[model samples]
Every structure is written in structure tokens, then in C-alpha cells.
Target: MSRFAPNRYRGKLIIVEGIDGSGKSTQLSLLSQWLRSQRLAVSFSEWNSSDMVKGTTRRGKKKQMFTPTTFSLIHATDFADRHERYILPMLKAGAVVCADRYAYTAFARDVARGVSRAWVRNLYSMAIKPNLAFYFRVPLDVALDRILGGRAALKYYEAGMDLDLSQNIVESFRIFQSRILEEYEAMSGEMGFHVIDATQSIETQQQQMRQIVMDRIGAALENDILRSPLEIDRAG
Candidate 1:
């Protein structure tokens, strides 16, 4: 399948991408709240959260049954389910859809796990191109510290133990994430990602994100009014 062009849907799609602990999720949540505060219809979608495949993915992870190929396929299934059910419908309804992660996650992680980059991109060719895609770039060590500081132990796949990168989970995580980071850097230009320095204060990052988003989509959203039934009836 060829790459799908940006949709002509009434809504806008905004997505964030980064390694785990890069605080992309937090920034996305803030952006969503700001959009809603502005009276725009907003919806949120998260990566790998599709109920259709969540249980299966959990079991696969528990049993450590996924190779690089199987891992890629499973995530693709999750994305497809969300795209059709949650993302597409909300977009068609003129909602600002905020995604915590998108195809870029698979592109970086799957390739880091030894899956072919071309195949991974082809798997997600049907995805709608986002109006704004933010890539939160943080140093690997900083990301590691943030995640580990909040957790007791890293999960098997989360730390990239499957690839035998290191005996120690922490070391393996560093190595694996570094590979993913390299892929993200290479893709930043190719994918037209607006890269943000994530080590700044949270307030600073959020301020920058808000300014960028407003600059990009403010004109389109400014006049988008959601009328109540009474208002609609009066107009009619």
C-alpha cells in the first residue's frame, strides 16, 4: 500500500512520539486539556490500548512468546483496531484527536528489535498523517533515570532483555533505547517531526507545545462552534 495522504476530515490529528519516559504522554494530556478548554471537541487515543488485542498482547508478553516479527504484527493489529474504531470516527466527526504514540513508535522499536524498517512502515501505510507530530527528544540517561526512579524493576521487553543486549536489565535498557533513539533521530528530518528538547522545565515544554499547536491549527479551530440541541433547533 502507498502512503496515505493527510486526510480531508473536518477534524485535526495531533500525535506525540518519543522513547519511554520522554514525557510525551504528559505533554499530550496538557495539550488535550487546552484544546477542550478552547471549546474544541477533543478525543484521545493511546498506542497498544485497543481492547481487541490487549489481552492477547498481555498473554504474549507474560509468556515471552513474541519474536521481533510477531511483536511487530501484534502492535500493528492493535493500531489497526484503534484507527478504524476510535481514530477514524472521531476525526470524521471533527474532533481534535490526540494520540499518545503513533506509527513512529513501531518504526523505531521494531527496527531496534531487528525487524525490517521497510516492512514496518508498509504495515502502517494506511494510517492518517497527523497535522502536527511532536517528537520529544531527551537524553537516554535522563530518560532512564526518570523511568527507573519511578519503578522497581523494568519489564522483560521494556528493557530489551529479549535481544540479550546485557545481563543487567538496566544496561540492556540503555543499549536498546539508544538504538531506538538513533532511529528516531534519523527519522526526525524524514518524517518532518518537530523536535522538542525534553530536558527543559515541564512548564517550558508545555508552553512551547501550546504555542506551536496554536500557530499550526488555531485558524481552523477558531470558528468551530459546538451548538447545543436548543441552539441547533433555533437555527433550524
Candidate 2:
């Protein structure tokens, strides 16, 4: 489970992962924009944002009708759609692709929900390994507090309502997120996740993230590792 070395990739794929309220989305968005500001071509993608399956997924969630296996398959399909339609093209265009969450998200969440880890891994074998995968580590209480403060009600799946872990919403979310954090920690070594202490100020966390990403960008550019499917067309 060693990480896919950045040397092997055509374009940099940076993935940010964490439990709910861990600030992963915010940091990734900021980093992507910042890279663009520096004139690095960039394209952003997020989990479950594919148009092909959005309506179906939303309806399933609304009715709370998806079992663990069904939920995993739906998300896997969504990821596959986006990977083909959005991610691959961006990478082939030599754009830095920053994904809010990637395959590791399924490896953690689906396993926590009772899907077999090996099955999930095999399901995502089509995935392109990320060049940089950052795992935002936050304390359960802190994440719960932040989520509660921002929203009036927790989403059913996020609260682990599907698992029936607890009666109280807050307690359920806490239990669920804690399990997800444990799963994330377990995969850190195997996935080469750059773990960040999310308790740090947003500025500090972002600074550290940028420094690492910038270094990778420089190395990839120097090695000409980013020339891709459109190299001939672009040259013409």
C-alpha cells in the first residue's frame, strides 16, 4: 500500500480527505485558487458532485432507502463518472487537479459502514492514485462542535443514522465521526496521507499545505512529468 510516487503521474492530483467539519473542503478550495493565482492551471473536483448520478443519489438519500452495499455502489458509480468525464481530461490538459475527497474516502467510510475493505479497494482499482493526499486530523469533540454550530440539523448518513448507533443526533454524529477518524488514521501509512493537525489556525494549516504542494509542483515541472495526451495537439 505504498503511495503512488509523484514521478509516475502525468499531472499532479492532490486529494484532501477528512471527516465532516474537518475543514478539508475549505483548505482544498483555497489551495486550488491560490495555485491558479500563481498561474498554475488547475481544475477542482468534489465528492459526489457528478451530474450523471446526482439526482439518483439525492433521491436515495432522501428516502433513506439505500443499504450499505447500495450506498457504496452509488458513490462508486458517481466517482467513476466524474473520474472519466472531469478528472482525466483535466489531468490530460496538464492542469493540477485538486479533489476534495477521493477513493480513500470510500475506503474509510464504506468500511466503517460494514463494506469489506478489500472489496472497496478492488472497486476503486480504476482510480488514479493521488500525488498528494492530505488527511485533516481533528478531535471528535472539536469536529462535532464545529458541525453543530454551523448547521441546525445533521444529515442522516453523516450522523450514522443508517447504522442506528445512537438515538440522539449529536451523540450519533460523534460516534460515527470518531469511527471514521479511526479508519482514516489506520490508512494513513498505507495511503501516504500527509496528516495535518486540524486544530491549528486555518492560515497555518493552509501555509504548510501550500509549501508542500508548491514543492511538488516545482519538481514535476522540472522533470517534465506533466506532458500528456494533448502534447502533440498543443504543439501543433
Candidate 3:
């Protein structure tokens, strides 16, 4: 049996995952806007944003003190805190919960850092499977260009400098992100990720994503709309 089970909550959980600069964040933002425009209850979460562990993560990164195992465990703690505090409660309240990254991010990135895949998966075994998981697929070169074009320099950890992949920060990012990409590809089939070609124009990608989301949960959203106070007032 799969370690992660489908959630039984009334709300829908939608998540997007990809290596950094894959444009998954942009797509999720657009989707969240659309969901709100439809009057569906919507909530948002981002990985590593939990206050509980953010300070520790920052200090560790600043000091370059995190080994792969400690990094993995700290992130797991962050996810756990968010899962219990924000995700579960909002989901139970029937809010459409959108996440920028979920456990799969850890699965891919942690394993790419040389953590054991089985151990990492076991760490996130309590996570509820997302109703829709989108993997934004982009070529490494394209993703690199996009990231570097926007930023003056890569942060040390973001470049995967801790792994000693390359002396060049840009090259290190390329190699590190490549490993993460491979992990995502391997898990896509097993985890049923809807892969999006992220190299396309932003509008086109967003259109396809919106359509897929509508197809998956349009009826449920419509029901929520109908039950909303404004709709009830109109009917009365």
C-alpha cells in the first residue's frame, strides 16, 4: 500500500512542484487568483515558511552548518508544523488549499542531496496526497537562464554549493538541479504528477493548468459557489 493516503477532507488540496525557476510559483499564483474569482474558499501555503523552524534554517544556512541529514530533518519539521497548523484545519473547513511545494519537494531535493530515498519517504509518510499535483517541467538551460537573469548571484545553498558539485556557482546549480529533475521524473509516474511543459509562454501554461484544475474539481467548486451566502441570498 502507498504510504501517503488520499485526504478525506471536504476541501481540495492543489500543489505545484518543480526545481527552482521552473515557473511553478507563477502558475500557482494565477490558479489561486482564478479560484478566488470563482468565490471558492482558498488558502495558500509555501514550503519552509513555517515560523517554527525558519530561524534555525536561516542560522544553519548562514553558518553553512547543515549536513544533508540535518537539512532533511529540519525541513520535515517545518512541513509537519505547517501540516498540522494551517493545511489540515483549512482543509477541514473546506478551503481550497494551494501549496507552492509539498513533501515531494523534500523527496526530490533531499534525495538529490544524497539522503536515502526510503528514509526521506518514511519521514513524510503522514502527508496527505494532494488532489492535484503539478510538476512544471523545464529544460535545465532554460531554468538556469530564467533564474540567473533575475538574480545578481545565487545564494550559497540555493546553488547547492554545500554538495561540492562544482567550484562555479552556476555550474553547481546546473548539476544540483539536474539531479532534482531526475528524481522528479522518476517519481512523476509513480506519484501521478501532471507534468506541465514549463517552457511554454506563461499565458498558455496558465490556461492549460486552469483547465486541468477546472476539469478535476469544477463540480465541487460550483457546489461551493451555490452554497455561498451571496448565492443563497440570490435564491431567496
Candidate 4:
């Protein structure tokens, strides 16, 4: 399993998803580094990464008026631009692309904010599905504690909001978390959905994540690796 056989997938589109403070970014970096060490050509991407999306997030944060659905829409646009301009092309070229966040974030967060699950799904209906999606699972309290301890100020939906809204969001997130976990679990039953424990120490989590990536990209882990497939063609 050094590298995928040329016929395996057009390229590998790996998406790491989770709630805030889920340590996804750290693990994503570690996994990407490991892939590079194996001589695989890997590129990294993130949501709200483009200038337009970043500006939207900033303006919304400043105004503190954007709803969950508004935020979700912005993120969806970001992904559309990202996929059309970056991801799809890379996959076509047979390159491994790892995304820091994906539509699942929108699906979860928006639903927590009261957006219908159908609405969220419909918004991302055209987005590309990931070859492997890693959900970092952690306790709600632990994640909130980490956020509170961090230095960053709250953004839009998080800032200057009443306790009612905040509390509603929190409770909603709990439900959203459970539902998304179930969804991921179901998908995993059918395909590749790897759930990583987000409660572990940073070093331990990174090592575990790295090992998972190495295993999935096994054999392809050697020198002069070719591009991995993005979509698994079962028909062939």
C-alpha cells in the first residue's frame, strides 16, 4: 500500500472536519507533512481561505449580525470557488489535496444555528464528495473550554450575542454533533469515513492521524509516488 495503484482513484481528496477547537488543523498539517515525506504530491486548502470569504467573515464579525444561514452561504460560496478553481483541477491532474474543512462543517454548524438539514444539504448538493473524511470527535464542554481559553475574540454569530442565542446555539450544536456523527458513522459503514479522537493530547493525536494517513496511502508511501485517485471508480 505504498501509493495507490494508478487505477485506484483519479486523486485523493482528503477532508478533515470537526467543530471548533477539534485540533483538525494541527492534524491536517501533520498528515500533509507525512504525505510529503512519503514523496507524495500533496496540496493543502482551507475553508474561508480566499480573500472574498475572509473579507466576508471579517465584516460579519465586525457587524456581528450575520445569521448561521448567512455564514453557511458564504462558506458554501467559498467552497464552490475553491473546488472550481483549485480542487477539481488538482483531482483531474491526479494530485492529493487535503482540505482543512468541508461542507460537513456547514451542515453541522448551520443546523445547530437552526437551519434545516435539508437546506444545508441542498446548498452543498453540487460540492464534491471527499474520498476520505476524518471527523475529530471531542466532548462539547472540552471544546468550549478550549475556545474560551484561546486568545481569539468571538466572531459574528459568537460576538455580542445574547445568552439566549448563544445557549440556543450551544444546545443546537449538541444535537448537530450527534446527528453529524451518526451521518458520518453511516457513511463509514459504506465507505471511507475515519473518526479520530479529538480528546487526545496534541502529539498523540497527530501521531495517530499521521499513521492513519500513512496506512490509507500505504505503499504509495515510497519515493517517487504517483498521484492518488480522487474518486474511487467502483464500476471498473
**Highest lDDT against the true fold, candidate:** 3
User: Per-residue lDDT for 1-236 in model 1, tens only?
Assistant: 22756778888889999999999988999988888777678889999999999999999999998999999999999999999999999888888889999999999999999999899999999999998999999999899899999978899998999999999989999999999999999899889888999999889999999999889887877755231233345655
Candidate 4 lDDT over 63-83, as tens digits, reads 766766677788888878887
Residue 25 in candidate 1, Cα distance off native in Å: 1.0
Total backbone collisions for each predicted model: 0, 0, 0, 15
Instruction: Tell me the alpha-carbon RMSD of every candidate.
Output: 3.5, 4.8, 2.8, 8.8
* Residue lDDT tens for model 2, 1-236: 63322324467789999999999988998887786665667788989999999999889999999899999999999999998898888887777889999988998899989899888888888888888889999988888888889878888997889999999877887887888889999999888788999999999999999888767666774453343333356655
lDDT score at residue 62, model 2, on the 0-100 scale = 96
Q: Best candidate per TM-score, number?
A: 3
Model 4: lDDT of residue 35: 78
- The whole-model C-alpha lDDT of candidate 3 against the native structure comes to 0.91
- What is the TM-score of candidate 4? 0.75
Candidate lDDT scores, in order, read 0.90, 0.84, 0.91, 0.69
Model 1 lDDT, full chain set: 0.90
**Candidate 3 local lDDT, residue 114:** 98
Give residue 126's lDDT in candidate 3 (0 to 100): 90
Residue 223 of model 3 has an lDDT of: 67
